[model samples]
Target: MLLILPLGISYLLRTDGIATDKYIDDRRNYIEQVLDTIDSSFSAYEQLIYTTVKITEELAPDKAEHEAALKLAFSSSRSALVYGIGIWYEPYSFDEKTERFGPYIHHIDSNNNKEEITYFWNTPEYNYQNREWYKTSLAAKEGEISVSPPFFDSDYTYITFGIPFSKEGKKTGVVTVDIVLPQLQGYLSDYNFSDFSGVYLTTKDNSIVFSKTDASNAAIEKHAMEGEQPGLFTDRTAVYDENEITSFFEGIGQKPEILTSETENGVFRIHAFLDRKAIFLNIIFRHSLQYLIFFLFWTSVLYLIIFNSSYLKRNYENRLLNTENERLTEEIFKRKEAESRLTFQAYYDEVSGLQNLNSFMEKEEALQPGNDNRSLIQVSLNNMKELSLILSSTIIDETLLAFTTRLKSVCPLETRLYRARGFSFFVVYDDQKTGSSQKLAEKLQNEFRFALRLGSRDIRLRAKIGLVYFKDAESLEQVLAMSQSAIAGLDVADSGRVGLFDHSVQEQKARHVVLDAAMSQPGFISELYMLYQYIVKTEDRSPAGFEALMRWKSSVLGSTVSPAEFIPMAEENGLIIGLGWFAIEEVLKAISGPLKNSGLFVTVNVSPIQFIELDFPDKLDNLLNQYAVDKNRLKLEITESSAAAAIESFWQIIDELIRRGYRLAIDDFGTGESSFHRLYSMAFDTLKIDRSFVTGLNLDERNQEICRSLMNIGKTMGSQIVAEGVETEEEHRVLREIGIKYSQGYLYARPQPLSETEFGKS
Candidate 1:
């Protein structure tokens, strides 16, 4: 929320800046355009008045006909302009009894003007002698114009425009024009010039004649008729003081951005007031949608934070209220404390009173200075993972405690013990307490003879111990690491009861490190090439097909890495996906080039990871379609261990692969729990016997029986049984006698690269 708030504020401020930039000029220009429009509208009235004055003067001035002048007035009234057009003469111009000739008003009811003129009666109020236009224009020069003080009627208040019309060398009469106040305002409505909320027009005397702001104010009316400074309009706006301007602005609600333009050479002024609030309001209106979107965005973000914080607060309070849980936790801690009695007991195992893996490592490191002869023994419990599936956690924990108690009694009292993991334990003893690894092994084996009784069950725990003797030649971590590797390979049923970590194990580990580093470099995949090993049918010892084995001659190592060493390394490090794809492409290329039309098929090894990949199916399909290779000629060998792990996913992948026209085989079948169960349950075209069983077929009776049984099972499952590692004819003869369908090994031919392999030569 803190981060989001600043960002949103900056965005809104940026929007405001952009809005101002885009709209300010538009507002100013709008005012100018509006003023120009009003100026143009008034210009038309000035032209009409001048044209009417000329036409009226051309009319016959005799007493017999005033109808022509009145007719001109009626034509001017067609525009709904002023109250009416009138001609007011100088007093007694027509006769001694007459003050004015006629003011032939062309108002809404002025159709009966002919009758009024025929029986004309002049009231004193309607007399032209007292009128402002008559007296002003009588004194005005021939071309001069005069304006009367605006007067009020029931519906309108207006001022009159007068021009002096003359006979030869005399000012005989005046032409007057009265513009209606309400009608003038209505005309101004179409000329929108600014964002002002109100508009009005004022006279040259600073008196407002027409206003949308306040039309009923007596002061403004008085100012229109009588003026402000002299209390009457002797002339112009020079008398308008600050108080009047202030009052004008106050009436509009604020100091409106009032733009005043002059139309009569600074006599009459047009005002367009653009309120400041209206400008901002317009800006807000323009950006309201964007503001709404940002509002929802910030609201959602803040709501999530507030909701999560509230949930956490309630959860914390609920936890605090559980007093019973605190008591149980304290009891568990006390029970764990009572199991180990030592100053450094915190570093020891909670279930068994032995030091933990961290403490064991610390103790081994501590013994480096002034170190006497030291031997670290690592004991591995072989079947704890299997037992965990069958036994309850409580029984397993109790069984482990009893086993550790037995181990402690057999060991020297001064020695320190440690539990490395759930299934592995560590013991550190110096030469002062133990004689040799052989004597220690015997003592450990002797202790194993007695079984512990746990809940009426005699549970015998079997373990393998890996021994390491040290004198600071290597770091304790390295020594313990070597011991763990040794223990991983040992079997509880083997004669090498206490395996010793040796030089061969270190060399293997070094080779593994070298291969791991080399696999990460460029062109590592180029180092890998396939060697085709021939498989012969037992029926005639003829070429059946070849299995593609991956071989590597690493440039960095300056030697070849055995497939046995680098293959598993690649699989574990996730480099096998790339390496496996490289092999597949090379094999397909071979089939597309020299091996085309050979009628012989080749088998390739695929890693479990690549087989289960989601994109693998599409990749293989594209490659096969591109190469135009027949599906029958390429078979993929899959490991049994991986197939059983993800049965459903593997089945789908295999089904798709076969549907696209390919074959499947189970490679190294006998290596991992070869019960022939998957051979019957899962889809497979062939079952390749592991090399281990084939190597011992002639020597071991059990190997001989297992092969015969596998062959029978393979035939029943309708899959051809292939025997690998057929190095000698004697072993091959035994496999041939066992009714094996195929055999592959060095006795037939060693694996050769594609360059050396002739398709039918095998």
Candidate 2:
């Protein structure tokens, strides 16, 4: 008995030792996973800070634009991660007229909802420039992000991440994003291995960013109250007296087994703590059966040993078999689960949870050979991209799901719905059921009449439905193309409209394809030319300048394409940039060669896409220098709609052009939602009233008033006013009486080839 006892004891000790090592190793692995999650979260935050800096640097010169842009930078997902964000500029840097301009947007809990409030933090009592975070951020090297020590704000604890931003190679300001400690605490707590285990995120300075236990919080608070720094008492004292710290934890009924890990950047540390008492209890419970078996075998060694020996051996073998079976069962289940997940992902749209395009195609291909009566209706959300700009991705996803649900509710039973793309869906149903397709289209249109509740906002979505009856002769790709063409034929202004694939839509689509193909050819640029129309003084009918209009005569089509038809197509296909550059260079060449001594300034219309290019100013400068044309003789005309849609960088580009001595004009005024503030803020030299208001200005009172108002605005801004589309003497006389200075229309002269004009002949 005595010899057997020592052997059993040795075996038990070895088993317990192995189990303890494995347990600690598993906990350490869990800590590593938690650290990885923390690192990823912080990396995202750092990326957000970098994005904010880039956006601020680009839009800094415009106050309203940059502020709105900064606000937009924080989407719902990002906003939820951060407590607040602040943009602090050096004194008089943002605005030379003011000594300070610091915009701080902070989240506040209002009625149990989080609301963001924007306020200038440059006030006397709360000068952000004097704060430690700001000072440290400013001292940081270029491109380096600095993290502030954990600090308390009101009842909440937070840590600030700061990055310095520069403009034109000089540091201008510091941008900071604040993270709430409790939010991080909740995040880390989710990774706790058990209720008895605690997770903590701490800074390099030992300041606790987050701790899962009330006891840890109380201990940190006690240490803080005792004039020690706000950090873990055990961590601070362990270096000097480890035994004292162990005794302190033991006194509190917590002999903790702690595992510590540092982050890659060493900015933060992760500490995992498990109660020693709980570990001891778990070890005892796990081995209690083995201890009992050993005791029983040894106590009955004389008579029962022979019988019990086989019983014990069989029991051990059965346990091993059960464990192996469970492991194999779990692995098989996991593999099957993985395969099912992959199949679902491939066949379904993750956002809407609807069958995807691949699934739809497969279903369509597998249809019975005689099933030729299926009709496809594409329901498209028109403003999804626009909505994405202002709404959260979560809201957009929810809206899409709700749209699918609503669609399914209206769809006929047995009809299949598929999400063809992000902003569109396909509804395939039987068209043989007499007007079924028409009825379904009507139902889909009616569904959009009601608003969908997306987060806090209720928005009515606009959809365009295109219907196509599947023909046995047409392939699925051909049918899809026809449906898209049908949708394209419907006017965008006619929201919620349904259109059917017809001969006219097909002709238009074919014509568009031909034109696009012609425009894509390398020699298409050479085939393009320009015509100049006279912009004359309204009073004297004498030429002040010429407006350059682009003309396209495609050799491939063997016909001249109208500007209205091909210009928008060019813009859509990104060919406008090339066309715009060609027009600018051609106009300059005409000015420098044919009209050098003509003393007429020529204005060329610029597309919004071209005007927004970062290198637009440089490209224009190069063209101007290459042609040796006077900058004053080349005026750039930007449409009012384009001007209204201009962002902060647009204004910056405009300033660059003005500084280079180029004159700018706002063409087609009164044709869009014209803002007085925008016009007043811009540095335009001319405002050309659109032909719509000028065509009947002599007869229509409303038209006259609009023209007069536009003229008054132009005159007030010291800009030359020109009336477009003037066709008669009466219209010209009225425009003259309305204080117009310049006029460009058929009444003066039609657009003619610059080489055939009288100036070119001279």
Candidate 3:
């Protein structure tokens, strides 16, 4: 038993020795990492200090003789530097008559202080004779630099980096920069260590420049409290004594590899103790080696268990992996099938695998507004209607297919065709000037003439082709409607060869003779003024508080062309920007005067094209200032479709308007494909529910839910909510109940001229 006990003890001793060595090695690595972190932190500090100095020097160029030095500093490629970036000097009063430095020095706080005259210098009252830093810099020649020891100057002790200024060969003046010691000290103080550790900056003479020392705790006290220099002790044991100073560093020259030499910017050195005692203790107690010992013990045990179970585990894992692989394969197959289905559905029309309604609309919408000059020709198959009446449904289907193929041959490659319900067809034709609607009508007439002439033997076909040139159409919808109307007229016309519907033909004739006269009204803003004062300014919530837009009213026709009609005309005529400026100014005037204390804001709907004017901000600013109204009290309403067209410029305009104090609200909120992400990015201050959404509230829960979601989103994204098209009191009450703060509709008042009564009602 005695022999076994000694053997166990020996084994334990050997294991402990190995663990201690490993611990020491791990601790060395950890110390190195900590030192590296400290080095990086010091480097950052140097950069911050240099940047601060350079920034100050740039800002304070008026300081005497510093501008040239700063300009040189900026031209350098090196981003980091210690000194030579800036020079700091005190302002001194010199007496020419006395030819001496002043006896009294004015303090930085503008207080006068008196002190005995220590010495005098060449620059009159500039007392440079006895000052250490001044003397050190003045004595040093050009291309030489010196760092002064920390000294007291008016209750504050700070360090200085000084270099002598030279012209040609001789020294002219001393340039110096003050260093904040406490800032550097505080920077070093951030590193906490209970184990014995200290940071110090020193000079070549072994003088301590800065040190981490506690005056109260002698055990952790600094080696030197106050002294001319530091040197090695006689006894190593006395080194730890509180009274005796143990030289922390041998000398700057003792270690040349670790030591750095002085340059124009001053020396930089990084050194630490390699044979410190506490560091050895820290190494022996390192946590990693202890963890490693336990890790190896468990790992050896785990390996044995794993070895025994390897075959069974391997078979189980293989089966699991195979199952996962099969599932993945099935998923991939299903995904491919779904993708093919989606691809087909995206392009194919639901009813017949041809172009869909969306395709036709997209083509029409994509046409460039002014330059295209495209003409639309809509052809309705009259024979199909007759076929539907006389033949079986299957026979009618066959004839419709044959008719589509024939139409495909005649239609241009760029033209879009839609299967408009049962027997009607819609087609859009692009720019072709010489080929008049008459020529198209005659061509279609000829194509059918042969079909009709042959009857059953030759394949009879008869239809009316409605033609409308888009030169006078106000919008895509207008053009589409006109074309369809022309086609509708032909659907009932006498059975014959293809012919243009008389309405479009008559409308075109009317548009030509009266088009200029129709367009010859006052510009959009001139009408906007009338609209703002009368129709748009109504208390009725229909277009209630909203600025109603004006359309041209012709005395002869009795029908009015809407603002949606004339505004685009105004833009095409190059008058929209001017009109936009006028509206903005007029709104500002109203908001600043009658609406001043009413908590009421004026909103003017602006065309996106008006933003192209670079002086929009200047005009807005002028109007904002002229009215003496806060910019926030005015709003600019922009349509979502227009905003999306010029999104980047739209954002810029919105940003500038906001910066100048005006609010922006997106008009027609649920009418476009404005994604929530896009809405979030826009950061609009207000959202106006589109009239369609408001009108659909009672009928469509989906519409109501969408408006509700938008209102919720607006609240989350910091926007005020407004709902338009409230014709009934129920609509107004419903909107208010849904947290909509503002509404514009017929429930309140129709737009009328603003008066004392109008103001009172508001």
Candidate 4:
């Protein structure tokens, strides 16, 4: 018994050390995951700020232009994390016209539960040029983005991210975006942590950005400043030293097992503290059975030693051994059950009771090269969002479960089903079982045609299915991405559509990948240039004005990409915003330079994405002011489809643009629905007939009558009519007979570079 006591003590010490190490490792992993989330959020904000800087740096340093550009930039990319965004110029640096020129745009939640974007300019009293964020950003090395430490401001804490903007090799200003600390805290709160665990995020200077503890920030900072050693489980058994660390633990009233980790950039530190008592309790609970078993074994050994009767001792030993064995078996079974539960939670969808994307990825990874022909189909419910708005969350969950059950019923027994994401499922099957992917996709679509009964409601759902066949030689990631692209290519207006990732889809995806990469490269926009096509009067074939059409000649592709291809790609990828700005500036430059004395208004096409921006009119005014061009000289052409599909806000933008002295034209007028109603609603300056109608006007009497009717409608509405795609003399004559005043097409002259056009030559 004396020897056993020492051995037991040694075992307890070893077990305690192992448990402490394991706990530390587990907490470290948790901290890492938390850091990952924080990093991802921060990265998104960084990209936004970077894009804003890129847009702001090119502005002409006018106050109105800066205000409009800053407002537009902030509003277009607004995020929940951002409190505000601003531009701070050096003293008398902006346009060299003022001592201070800082413009800030931020959101204000009004009493009516609506967000209002408020704009503010720096006053003499509030000189933002002298602020820490601005000064630090200006002092930073060229091209370096600076992240300011959290500071208290206006009843909230904020961390500012700023990048210095330069003009002609000299730093002239700083562009910054501010993140609200409480919003960050809200993000962190989404993660689940132990009740006894506290997490704190701090800057390198030990200023707390967020803390889960009840201690005040000042107390935490003071404790950190006193040089408290940050280590994993350092002195884990030590009690709280009241005199030395009382302030830090004033609220907790207990010692903490602290673990600290710094971000890779060393900008921020994460401190995770577990209550020492809680840690010890958890450790004891985890190993109590092992300790009990050890004690029982020793007790049985002593019992055997004390008893000399062979039969009685044997019986007693057998019973004790059997009891210990049963307990051990039970413990093993419980552990296995826990492991199985964890595995299910990791790889299976909780709502659908099916395997998840992780399991699908694992299956994909395990596929052999010569395996049977397998096809992957992704089925996505198209109306989940609409249904969610009208139904309770419980109903939505029930609908998802019902949908998955129906999907499983339709799929072959040999098929493997996976929950890809919300209301989306993936089915994998070999050709032998499903016969063909097309047949299976059709069957699934047919199944969704029937109404699903849920309690008292009959819910009808539409699905989009994207299928891809693979021989296991291709990368599954690429296959999956292709499937997604195929799904995206399906018309949103259509329901129950099935698409295959065919050669055309593959080519389009490749082109988009290449275009996205090329556009991301520095100075890629320099490869883009504008061509001018003459808009001539139909009566005399005399040039009235020109349409500025953007063209791109990619050095990377060794060919010129047609606008038909890249424009849609640009719109999809959000590069259209930058490209739209480029087009505006280029057209204004041409009007103010080469075509200054021409007395002709150059029309620029405005994409719906750009036109719908709330600050579109203001941005246009800014550009016009910067270039010193008359707003009337640069016409904005929005597509008829865009106008027809526009909401009430679209009219507001159009009205504002017209109020600011810009002429608006509806391009491709005849192609959209309800043309007469749309024309009657707004006072458009010009109407451009679609190319399709004008293409065969000379040959088809129906097209000629259509063109004539459209021209009459435009004339009746006091709008000038322009006929497009007049390729020959006969088409031009037909347009003239139809009383179309303006015409633009190959018949006048093929679109030519500015230098080769009459305006540039003059």
Q: Which candidate number maximizes TM-score?
A: 4
Model 1 lDDT-worst window of ten: 230-239
lDDT of 1 by residue, 46-68 (tens): 65566566545544444334554
CA lDDT of each prediction against the hidden true structure: 0.68, 0.76, 0.53, 0.75
Alpha-carbon error at 239 in model 3, in Å? 99
Deviation in angstroms for 475 in model 2? Answer: 33
lDDT of 4 by residue, 1-762 (tens): 749956995788577878877877887888888886777667767777776776665565556666656666666564656778887777656444543456777657411223434433466767676677778877877667787777765545688888887766677788888887765655665566654355667765555676554444565555566776322112221222323333356434556677777776555677777666666666777878777777777776777778867887889888887887898899899999999999998899988899998888886655454564888888988677556545777998898899888888888798999987666788887887658878898888778888889999999887888887766335777667877876878765545568876677767767789988887778778899999999998999888999999999999888998998888878755688889999989999999999999899999998866766546777777878888998778888988887776544456567777777778898988888745765676678998999999887889999988988888888789898988888989998888777788899997899998899877887
Model 4 ranges off by over 4 Å: 1-30, 38-468, 471-527, 553-581, 607-633, 647-662, 673-684, 737-739
Query: Worst ten-residue run, lDDT, model 3?
Result: 251-260
Residue 246, candidate 4: Cα error in Å is: 14
Candidate number with the higher TM-score (1 or 3): 1
- Candidate 4: TM-score? 0.51
For residue 560, what is the lDDT in candidate 4?
A: 92
Expressed as tens digits, the lDDT of each residue in 1-762 for candidate 2 is 558866886789678867876787788887888788788777767767876786677664545775665565554224455877778888747455643457767667521335564656567888878888899889889878888877776656678888998878899989888877655654554454564345566776555666544356676576566665433443321222234434445556776777889888776887767676667557866677677667655645633455657776677657756765785698689789999999999999998888998887677863343457888889888767556645667888888989888998989877888998558899888877545788889888988888998667898787889887776325777777877877877765566568887876577777899988988798999998899999999889898999999998889999889999988898766678888998999898899998999899999988876766546898888888888888899899988887776666777788788888899988888787767886677668988889999887889999999988888877789888888999999999998888788999999899999877889888
Pairs of residues at least 3 apart in sequence or in different chains that clash in candidate 4: none
User: In order, what is each prediction's RMSD in angstroms?
Assistant: 44.6, 13.3, 36.7, 12.4
TM per candidate comes to 0.38, 0.46, 0.35, 0.51
The local lDDT score (0 to 100) that residue 83 gets in candidate 3 is 24
Candidate 2 Cα misplacement greater than 4 A, ranges: 58-66, 74-78, 91-97, 108-124, 189-197, 214-247, 250-256, 262-268, 275-281, 299-649, 658-672, 676-762
lDDT of 3: 0.53
Comparing 1 with 4 on TM-score, the higher-scoring candidate is 4
